[model samples]
Target chain A: MSTTNAVELRNVVKRFGDIAAVDHVSLEIRDGEFFSLLGPSGCGKTTTLRMIAGFEYPSSGSIVIHGREMATIPPHRRPVNTVFQSYALFPHLTVAQNVAFGLEMQRRPKDEIAARVREALEQVRLSGFADRRPRQLSGGQQQRVALARALINQPEVLLLDEPLGALDQKLRKELQIELKSLQRRVGITFVFVTHDQEEALTMSDRIAVMSQGKVLQIGSPTEIYERPTCRFVADFIGETNFIAGKVIENGANAATIETPDGLRLRGLTPRPVRVGEPAVLSIRPEKALLLAPGDARAGHAFAIPARVELVSYIGSDTRITVRLNDQRTFDVWEQNTLSTLDRDAYWQPGEPAVLVCPPDNALVLTE
Target chain B: MTLNALERERQRRERRTLAALLTPGLLWLILFFALPLVIILVYSFMTNGPRGNIVWQFTLGNYVDLFTRSIYFNAYLRSIWISVLTTVICLVLGYPLALFIVRQPPRWRTVLLFLVLIPFWTNFLVRIYAWQIILANNGLINSALRSLGLPPLTLLNTEGATLLGLVYGELPFMVLPIYAALDRFDFTLMEAAADLGASKRRAFWRVMLPMTMPGVAAGSVLVFIPTIGQFVVSELLGGAKVDYLGNLIQRLFLRSNPPNWPLGSAMAMAMMLVLLALILIYFRTTTEEDR
Candidate 1:
């Protein structure tokens, strides 16, 4: 991939009258990257995508697409297309006609338009459903038609706003994989917006996690999930266990925190933390390992004595809820790696155990 | 079998309920609507007596005179031309107004629709008289011109005044249906069109206009049929100078030098058939997507 940016925003702000829907968000979507803006509803992720597509303008910042400042350009003049959440297929037009709309608007010759439309439909695997109206197609079929319609334009950037949000779970997962591969084959820069974190994690090359109109973090899926720099990012992405405490020592690469009950825990400090300041230590549920007390000291891992409160065996993993010595409850998911039918093989409730996690796997985050 | 008997009983009850629902409307149409047309049809084939009386003698003279005479032929053509012009003008003026109203915020949309409907609060005839006061030679525009020391042009007692009055009377009919269509329109489709690189004008033609066509067809029918048969505007505003089909029919039936009932019935029948044909053709041309 080229190092050049396909789209860039410099401290963009969008306000609806008195309230800012997007506040000082600046990002550079690299060329041909499948970038995602992920957050819950009302976080301004869709608004940011709209500004990139020229549907909504930034209230107070510069937007550059391929090095050209897009200050006054209208949506039709912008070299971008959008796949709306509703699909927005023309109900009156057949599938092929809908896919050919963009080229027809550009006044291309009839034969070239026809050929490009055929190729676009084939790319989305809807080659035989061309003559059907939008209402006649199922939801997934309509979504593919929408994709074919937008992709036929060969735009420099493609904006997708929760395009799979209305589908069933099985269909959504199927489309997620299909869409990611389609983006790769086309090699077009995609700026996707969704509230589904798993969907974002599975499909995106990089992600921008937003909350309340501000971008909290931006990184790859691994960096975002494994090493969130802030408390919101850690809490928003997945299931996390947070223990509120005060920092007792700030070392070169890690910080140690003491809880109110006088239990000490050390974790990696992804962001700066001052000594004696209030902070929180965060660890993912799957990352924390539950082991017998004798196995805790084998790898220089930090260990806390706990009693198993509850054990629930799901097929893929065993979820164990444990109470720490300081009286805080923590959850740990142990993967079911071996096939076993014996009931006595699993850990029972009220049993003594140790909760251990590597220092690098835990993060010390600031509010 | 018992199952067959149950199905038969269900079908009988459904038929009874359908008949009960349709009885009143059917009776009303047959008595007040179909009976009058039948009377007109029977009268058109009879001879006219010397003193506005219908004589029991079969003749095709009225139908022949309707087609062969210059006066009746010219009146039919003029009425059609005037109605068509009025419908076109109303569409041109009302579409943008409907679009503008639909685009407003909800509170403002209600207020604007109220303004469009405000004229209906008064009697329709009173409204036409009000137009007469505005377009008269010594009326609103001429008075304003006189105040500005400009020459007062002839404003009333012309075809222009008649056309203006018809358009003013029928504009709400044109605006309401188009507004209803636009109000239900999904605005996101416009964004999709623009995102696909279509200019605002092209998007309007390709997306907005075609989807909203049902409203246009409805509005045209509402305006055209009424304007074609109108006589009050021409009489009051055009000073009874020209004979529209409605005025001519009125004279034949009620206010002629000597009443001509057979010819009047023939003329009315011809006008109704022509209108029915035009409406069918208009709907067929506009609704290709439905097929």
Candidate 2:
């Protein structure tokens, strides 16, 4: 991604009647960057994307696209184009006609419109299917046509509202990679919106995780997954096992928390955690390990004795659900490699085990 | 063996029950609709007797006379022309009304649609009489025009009054279907067009109109078919001076001495034929897009 900012939203707020659908969202998307708005339904991510596309006007703030204020501009006049969630391909028009729509609106030369339409179709890998209507194409092809329709305008910013949402899982994964590569090739700032965390994580250069009309965090995929600032973000971005505890000691870069069961745990603190403050210790399922009951623990290794209540083998990894002596459950995922147990030797119901995780891998959150 | 036979008998009995339940509506149509049409057909070919009863002799005189007589031909043409004019005008007026209704907020759409149907609930003849008062000389419209410093234009006993009555009577029939079609219209298609660079006008013409064509056709048939056969509106508003085919047919059957039933039957058959042809043309035009 380039350092130049292509689109900027300055304290934008959108209200539908009394409800603030988008509440004071401010973000800047860099030129050529693939940015995603990740949230659940009613999180106002789509509303924010619409504001940038000029489909919706911000109630209280300005939208700057390529250094121009898009407050009064309509969607058609904006330098941004949108690929709607429904694809929204003109059903009555042929594929060629649909793709040529933007060009025709620009009042381009007839010959040039035809040539560009052909080129756009080829770019989307739909070369010879121009005469067919949108209804005749498969969902993936329709999505490509939607992409071509927006991209042909050479827009400064392209807004995609769940473009792959209608596709099946297999097609969604295939298109995710394709869309990311397409965004890179086109070199235009792509503002994508999706509620699927994996889709956002796999494709976006940066993701803004939103909930209840407010963005909880905006960070790179690694940062969002590894260093989420809030409970919502930590739970939303990935799986986490949270333990309620009080901070017993605070060091320079790490902190120690004592669980209600009197188990002491040490973890690196991304944020300040004062001693005596209540906090939650978060650890990823994959970061935790299943150890034998007799294994010795080190100073930085936190281990808790538990009973394996369930073990599920999910292709590449085996997930074991363990219930601690204090009645709290924690999940541990082990990669299915040679070093792990064979399918027959995996944990059984009520098997005694110890859940161990490195101290540095534990995340501390103030709830 | 007896039980198996009884079970099979039960299945057959249930089938018979379904047929018996459906027989009444089927028989009703055959008696009230099909039988009358058959009678009209048989009477159109028979000769009218001295006492206006149908004679046993088969003759084409009534059909021949219908074509040869200038009065009958003119009346038929005038009714057809008026119905066509009314259908066109209703389409032009109703489309925008439907569009406006569809564009309204969802909660208001029901109330607005109800407003369109309220006038239809009143008795047809009573509604025509109400219009007669409104369009009459020194009536509401004339008074309004005079108050505006305009000359009191003559409206009653003219073709303009008949056309106005036709449109006013059939407007709800035209508006509802169009509203339904437009209300269900995929607005995303229009947005897609606008995004592709279509001006608002182009988007409306290319996307909006084609999608709603079926509604337009249905509304046209709804307005045209009834207006063409209507006698009450013309009799009340046109003052019986302008003889439409419906007025001619009514006069022949109800008022003429000895009741010229054969000619009336022939005229009625001709009207059915015309309506059938128009409907066929409409269906053909609409379905051609599929191919």
Candidate 3:
């Protein structure tokens, strides 16, 4: 990707009367980046997307798109097109006509408009649906038509506002793959807005995790999932066990915290070194290993004595709800790669086990 | 065999219930609408007696007289012209109002609709007379003009006055249907249009206008047909001066020395035919959107 940012929001704020829908939010969406604004509903992700699309103007600050200031620019005049959450296909128009609407608005040659519209439809794998009305198509087909309509414009930035949100899980997965590859082939900047963290992690190169109208962290999926900077970021992205604690020993590369029940947790950290401060140890269930009694220990792995509160086989993984000796509960996810045919040897409810998670896997956050 | 017998009994009972459900509406149409139309048709063929009573003799004279008279021909044309004007005015005013109402917050939408419907609480005739007071030369409007030291223009008993009254009376008819269409409209399509580089004006024309057209068509039909047959507004607001079909029909039926029941019935039949024809044309133009 080029050095130029495709879009930039400089401390943008949007207020709905007394409430700030987007509050002093600043971010850079690089050119050709599959950047996503990931958050729950009413988190200002969609509002930020709308502001970039020029459907909404920020109450304060400014948005610049492709080196041009987008302040006061109407949606149509901006060099960006959005695939709305509802798909928003024009019901009166045929699929081809809807795709051609933008080029025709710009008064392009009829032949060019027709050619581009056909190409767009083909890109979305909807070539034969050109003459059909929007209402005549299935929801997935209509969604493809919406994508084709926006893409046909060949705008600088393509926005998608939870475009796959309404689809069924299987259909959403299919579209996620299709959309990611489409973005790749087009090589256009995509600023997707979605509440589904899994969808964001799957499709986007970088995600901006947001909450309460503010961006908490912006990082790659691995970075975000592995080392969330705050409790909300750690909690929002995936299932994590947050054990409240006080920092006992702080090192340059690692920190140890004493928990409420007097259990100490040592974890990796690149943040500040400070002792006697409130902290939290974030551990993903997948990263925490469950070892039956008398199992050989990895020298660097921290082991905790716990009893299974709940045990359920979930095909890919066995989820064990464990209550620790410290009187705190934590969930440990064990991949069921090993044969579970020996039902008697399997960890039953109330069975004792050692929760062995590597120290490096834990993230100690002092936020 | 026992199950089959029970199923047959249930089907018979269900059929009886269905018949019972349909009877009231069918009976009402027969009693009120179909019977009145048949009586009007019969009256058109009968001769008028010296008094207001109908004569038993069958005659084609009423139809013949209606066709031959310029006063009746001119009156029909005038009413059609006035109705057309009123419908057009209503459409022009109602469309933006419907759009505005639909875009308002959900709480204000009901309040705006209530405001549109509030005028219906008063009797329609009483409302027409209120318009007369507003339009009269020495009434509220002209008096305001006179107090401003401006020359008081003739306001009542004019074509403008009649047109204004017709529009005023029929406006709610137009607004309601258009509002209903807008209420069911999905605004996302308009946003999509704008996102695809259509200006506000272009988006409205390309998206908003076409989708809401069914509403306009329904509203126009509602306003046009009734406006053509209206008599009271023309009488009060036009000060009985306008030669509209409704005023002319009223004169022929009630004010003549011998009430021309046959001639009036003939005129009414023709007016009904015209209304039916207009509706037919409207239906022809708008096939079900099906989209």
lDDT to native, each model:
0.92, 0.88, 0.88
Clashing pairs in 3: none
DockQ of 1: 0.83
- What tens-digit string does per-residue lDDT give for candidate 3 at B34-78? 998898899999999988789988998887877788888788888
Model 3: per-residue Cα lDDT over A95-115, one tens digit each: 999999999899999999888
lDDT for model 1, please: 0.92
Q: Write the per-residue lDDT of candidate 2 for residues B1-291, one digit (tens) a residue.
A: 999999999999999999999999999999999999999999989888898888878889888888899899888888899999999999999999999999999899999998998986788889888887898889999999989999998898787787888899889888988888888689988877766666678888988988888788889999989988898777888888888889989988989989988899999999998999989987975685454
Error in Å for residue B134 of model 2: 2.7
Range of the 10 consecutive residues with the lowest summed lDDT in candidate 2 chain A: A294-303
The native-contact fractions of the candidates, in order shown, are 0.90, 0.59, 0.88
**Rank ordering of all candidates by DockQ, starting from the highest:** 1, 3, 2
Model 1 per-residue lDDT at A83: 96
Tens digits of per-residue lDDT for model 1, A7-80 = 99999999999989999999999999999999999999999999988889999999999998998999999989
Worst 10 residues of 2 chain B by lDDT: B282-291
- TM-score winner among the candidates? 1
Which digits, one per residue and each the tens of the lDDT, describe model 2 over residues A1-367? 4666899889989999999999988898898899999999999999998888766788898989878888887777878888999999877678998888888889899999999999999998999899998889999999999999999999999999999999999999999999999998989889999999999999999999999989888999999999887778889988999988999999887888899989988877777889999988889999988887887763348778899999888888889899998999999998887665456676788989888889879878785
Q: TM-scores, in order shown? A: 0.96, 0.85, 0.91
Docking class of 1: high
Q: What is the lDDT of residue A332 in candidate 3?
A: 85
How far residue B53's Cα lies from its native spot in candidate 3, in Å, is: 8.9
Candidate 3 lDDT: 0.88
DockQ of each: 0.83, 0.47, 0.76
